[model samples]
Target: MGNRQSVVREAARFAEWVLREVGRELRVARLIAGMTQGQVAGVLGTSISHVSRVEHGLIKGAGLVALSRHAAVVGLKPWIKLYPIVGRPLDRAQLALFAKFRDRIAGTWRVTLEAPMPIPGDLRAADALLAMPGCQCMVEIITRLADFQAQVRMAHRKQRDIGASRLILVVAGNDTNRRAVRDAGAAVRDAFPLDTRATLAALTSGVDPGADGLVLL
Candidate 1:
């Protein structure tokens, strides 16, 4: 319970930090495009104050529609880069593993790496989206498990957008990762069963895994 709350709180803080940085970047983009707040407002069909609020991060939970339109006019594309929850140092190692994992099964599955789903508020970049004959699967790579609850929440959210028949949480093969999975308890298992063999077999055989599961690499 304490772990769950801590995970949720950290996820919320990370989200807030991303929003602040987005606001700052948007302001910089506006400047770079040589557009004032008023100009952006005019293009967005809103008041200059509204544009100012957005630029200043005063607007809460800004949707993708507004963001896309504003960026299109200002010659800036709104994008979010996904980094391991553990931190940037894990980026190269984690991403490489994710790619290799995808490549290993690519002979059988049609895999899309770093697939983007523009879901407002729950925007996520799927590390791998695997498609076989009948099933579409969302594969997420976790080098280190920072937050199980947050990971579950995100997988649930992304499932709708990815339209996956199943979800697989792929974790790096390490002591820390294995311990985190062990500590995740029954609820996490209920959501994502730790069954790498079943997942791999399903991918290889082009059949559905029948439920959410784990893939250890």
Candidate 2:
């Protein structure tokens, strides 16, 4: 029993170490990003003091979710840059794919195509988006597609830039996809086309849009 207690105490200490290190890294990342605590706090729904405390190794129970949100605000989002291998840089094709998305993606809503979804080909399929009753959705789709370079362009597609949104990138030929993620103003979630709602829900419960897009298909 004493030994078990000792192990438990050690585990707790390790966890705390991880949080502190993350907080330290978070502070460094924020500085490099040229973002203020207040700015980051606004995005995370927390106060400047809270961000300061977290950065100073003062947060008591900073969970993974909070850490992720803070990391994103500080621009330390995972896959922001791809290191297929340690100490390795991305190749040209890989760089172009990433740049395509980075340059093309803008506005408040961002859509990434990773996995394919089952949607109808007829106009009826877009009825939901068409029925939005305003130009907000149109602006989002335009901002989304125009942000990237694609062989296939759509005249009309449905999407939105509301927060708490995610999508999969249907990467085909060429390898510039990695750059799309690194240069994003916001987080560009690198996704496999196979990731599904069930899988996403397991990670974090949020809205994920479909990836099968076409202006006229």
Candidate topping lDDT: 1
lDDT (Cα, tens digit) per residue for candidate 1, span 168-199: 88888888887887888787668876478777
Going through the candidates in the order shown, the clash numbers are 0, 23
Q: lDDT of each model, Cα atoms only? A: 0.75, 0.44
Candidate 1 clashes between residue pairs 3 or more apart in a chain or in different chains: none
Question: How does candidate 1 fare on TM-score?
Answer: 0.56
What is candidate 2's lDDT per residue for 5-115, written digit by digit as tens? 875776577557756777899999999999999999999999999999999877868776787888988878632221111112334543455455334333333323221
Q: Which RMSD values do the candidates have, in order?
A: 12.0, 20.7
- The TM-score of predicted model 2 comes to 0.36
- Minimal lDDT window, size 10, model 1: 81-90
Model 1 has an lDDT value of: 0.75
